[model samples]
Target: MAGGGIGGALGGLIGLACAVLPGPAPIAPVSSVDTSLWSAATLERGRQIAAAGDCAVCHTAPGGQTNAGGFALETPFGTVYSTNLTPDRETGIGTWSYEAFQRAMRKGIARDGSHLYPAFPYTAFAKMSESDMMALYAYLMSQPAVRNSPPRTKLPFPMNQRPLVAGWNWLFHDERAFVPDETRSAQWNRGKYLVDGAGHCGACHTPRNAIGAEKGGFAYLTGGSAEGWDAPSLVGSRAAPVPWTEDTLFDYLRTGFSAEHGVAAGPMGPVVAGLSTLPESDVRAISHYIASLSPRVDPAVSADAAAAHAVRASAAQTLDDEGGRRIFESACAVCHAESGGVGHFGVRPLMGLNTSVALATPDNLLHVLQHGIDRPATAELGYMPGFKDVFDDRQLAELASYIRARYAPGQPAWRDLESASARLRAHAH
Candidate 1:
């Protein structure tokens, strides 16, 4: 588990909605024409929560717009766009009642009775409480209605079909609401709720089986293969040059940085930006939440206790051809060596990155090495150069193997650069 760091759950409920095109699907939910529960306070809170969730960032495409519903999400399955959530009677949800709206957010069902794809994150949103869900509904209703109809979706072949989705839901969806554990600290439990619910971090952080359900046991946020990007692990990650402390995590969520780690980049960058604007209490809660995930210790790392870390770190200096030392020198040492580099635009070291040594494999490492992620670009953000050109496949493979072996501890080296290269090629369209 991220243990006090977020995996940047979700934003716009972007996805395919095919029920009403020529003819609606049978599962399409008919609108419930009721308005008895639309409360003003709830609507206001919903708007605030929506902002915290960064709904517009994904739902609204570039150019001045509000719920225009056509921001294309470039996934491994081609591209998907944001849905029309405004109150337009036709193109938007003008006809949707509070119950219908709540159902869509919680159940991945459309007001018109269609099963929403998991791309909308109803699985994660389902963890939200009834009050919070109502607030969200109010916020959506308050938004300006756009009559613009989005283009029809074109998912790749079999995945394009909807029936296949029911099975996917059966495998992944958990409808039970979050029930706090009293034995744990309130903060810890809060962290748990956020991680499992609002943070929904596991949807991405956890690996999936061939059928795409989250691999039930150990693979659960120990990290896994994501479609467009390799999901990094949140397990006893010591990825930051400094230790992964709550205070440091607080800084990263608030400012998108800590002295040791890179600013949020890739898919996480946008989510970080969303977090930076959230309430400190919520951020702290999220931190607390991440900290409460299932406990673990990297057997290979030798330093189970944080206090023992320095000793283990010292031992790293003696890494002869160990994965840690070799990787540090080859790709990471330049920026990470005490004064070698500063921030990501400069260098963040590999000594204690949880992101580095926590995973069972090198997908994240390979991605960073092969693609060379830097802090993603914001208006004032700096750029990170892609390093696919700098390191060849063999070197990346070696470096990845080296880092994972050294930091991840018990895990055996499993990546072959030749194989990694071949997979990259295979993924290419």
Candidate 2:
């Protein structure tokens, strides 16, 4: 249901309707740049710049419709798809003027001048410069056009409506262009622009308000999520038992591994894998941007003297059983062993992963073990399977307790899967 077979067919129908409609496009025209301004080198730069925007990862359909717009973007309110940005006369942006493109990209308005749902992160992009905007347009103009139409989403009652989106915009969106802080070095400012503007990483990584818009005025990198994956804070000051240094974060961003951080899991896993395809320089730039943020130490972490040293002195033990180790060897060794048994099918190292070790709460780990986990929970494009029926509470606890000791933080601890399962069910999207 989450992937194309049904969603794609439905989305394609919706795309056809929107493409066939006759009227002003949802966006307005953008000002022109001299064609001479876009030379071969500039086009290449534009291509790299385009990757920073990460368009294909969100817009393309499963089994790859490249830019044809049939993939579903799940939200707390409803699901949406990446719109066609191809130059197709009917199914894409063939007739869009520069001004309209700018408005849509920066203001969340469509060529038709209608408001777009914030699921598209124009609020962050609104900070991008007009020149860079031209570059993006050039890049998009160069891509191949696919003719598929996506489904017309069926939203519940009032949430289905649009005009109200304008009001939502006024309350939550920031309309200003970015102001460079002269006090900061040029590299820092460039990093800021890339992350806050074209990258749009904050759209998912940042915490949201009751109304679901980002809590913008905050340092802009504290983490929050409703999906099973909890985006850790980027601030880096939090005393996670696993330390994330610049070198560590950079390696993970580039090759998807660092001694401190493992390959990304959940939604982040796919994102990093995609980012890995991008040039290393751009990835480094992204690191520069994130590293510039002052690490904010959470009160809970800052006040804990034990966690500061990452010491497990006070953390509870997960097991009291002699059979714990044998249970793990029999049931989990294939995926958790050092011979690299963990592969792309949601089998993570399970060792040294912070989530596995966080048995204090145990909600995330238990939910995955009980129900299995959907790695790319929304769909493949990224795939993580669910395992609910595989093991009951007691077996899971035994295996989990053993694995945590061998691989996760020190002093492996046992937990109540019943309580964890209930919490996961109540909050699952």
Candidate 3:
């Protein structure tokens, strides 16, 4: 009797799992796309949408064809390669019908009805308007197709089961369309839509749970990590010594440099590059929306005054560590020093005002020191040479500690610098 009861309970559990595991039927592939069906305006709009989404940044591999895919994304589960977005019959999405594309973008389901990993950001794309989605589809179909198939994403054990993604979706995915708040201005609404939808800013800036889902409510845009670099918080708790205003944010997003903050680095470098193609108005809207979320600086304290104060604080601690001071003066001060004049990149970034120095962790500062900026946000902004080969673990740690002490006097000192530097170096290799 006991054996029979156990078997019955196991069978019930299996039945429940089977009911939820089935996915949508696969859509038949098309022979060729009819480009004439889409108007020129639609194509242009789609191009803008693609830029906002930074699609090419993720889809294109280094030195590879645009939108042909092969860029590998490292996640907690494993590496997932981006798929080809071009209109190729075999390897790309050329055979995909508009309906199939729509489902994939909004539902995280492929044309063949397989559950796509959320790493594709379909959860965010689902909020985009139908017109915008169609425009993107039209634009992609019009691009030059490359016959390339990216490596299939393979995870260990039970994670290899794509059907399990359905459960993840049920738990975390929100497919509701964006509704503009009537109280807000049109510009603000537009900015919010772009930021939350196509931009998917939270994907990088928001903290995530153990299951890899972004934490919402109080945790939205409270800072996260991407490609091993810290994506600083965009909310009231921003790490930059100076609070960001709409004007500053606009300049940063449009030009990839902010006089009061710092240049875009890490994964943010690609995002800024993409934003450079957008219309000034759209950029302004985005800046406006993001600024609204941040707490305003004291009205009595002017930005210039605040900057001067920070510089003074950093300078006060310059002599605290002789070893670190020597390294900074010898290796970094030429461009970063207040009186160093214009750097090789035409602009000398003050370390005191840099966001990397003020961040809660030394991750961004360490990354910049080790890898440098091979590609500046813009060509004219100039490049930074990495010190990976120049500095050993001890030197790297000392330099980082000195910079933090000098620049961010109020924040707690970063611990375990030597170990952190060693770990980052190993990961880079």
Q: Pick the candidate with the highest TM-score.
A: 3
- Candidate 2, residues 149-209, lDDT tens digits: the string is 7776666544565555665665677878888989987766877887788777787778876
RMSD of 3: 4.8
Misplaced by over 4 Å in model 3 are 1-17, 298-302, 313-318
Question: Candidate 1, after superposition: displacement of residue 391 in Å?
Answer: 6.5
Per-residue lDDT of 239 in model 3: 72
Candidate 3's error at 316, in angstroms? 4.3
Candidate 3 colliding pairs = none
What is candidate 3's lDDT per residue for 326-383, written digit by digit as tens? 9998988778777644446546667777878888778888888888889887776788
Per-model CA lDDT versus the true structure: 0.59, 0.62, 0.83
Name the weakest run of 10 consecutive residues (lDDT summed) in model 1.
Answer: 5-14
Query: What is the C-alpha lDDT profile of model 1 across 181-217, one tens digit per residue?
Result: 8888887776676667766677778876544456667
Better of 2 and 3 by TM-score: 3
Better of 1 and 2 by TM-score: 2
The parts of candidate 1 lying over 4 Å away from their true place are 1-44, 51-54, 57-67, 71-81, 86-89, 144-151, 155-172, 215-220, 235-243, 260-262, 294-336, 340-354, 357-361, 369-381, 388-414, 418-429
Ranking by lDDT: 3, 2, 1
Which run of 10 residues does model 3 get worst, by summed lDDT? 1-10
* Best of the candidates, lDDT: 3
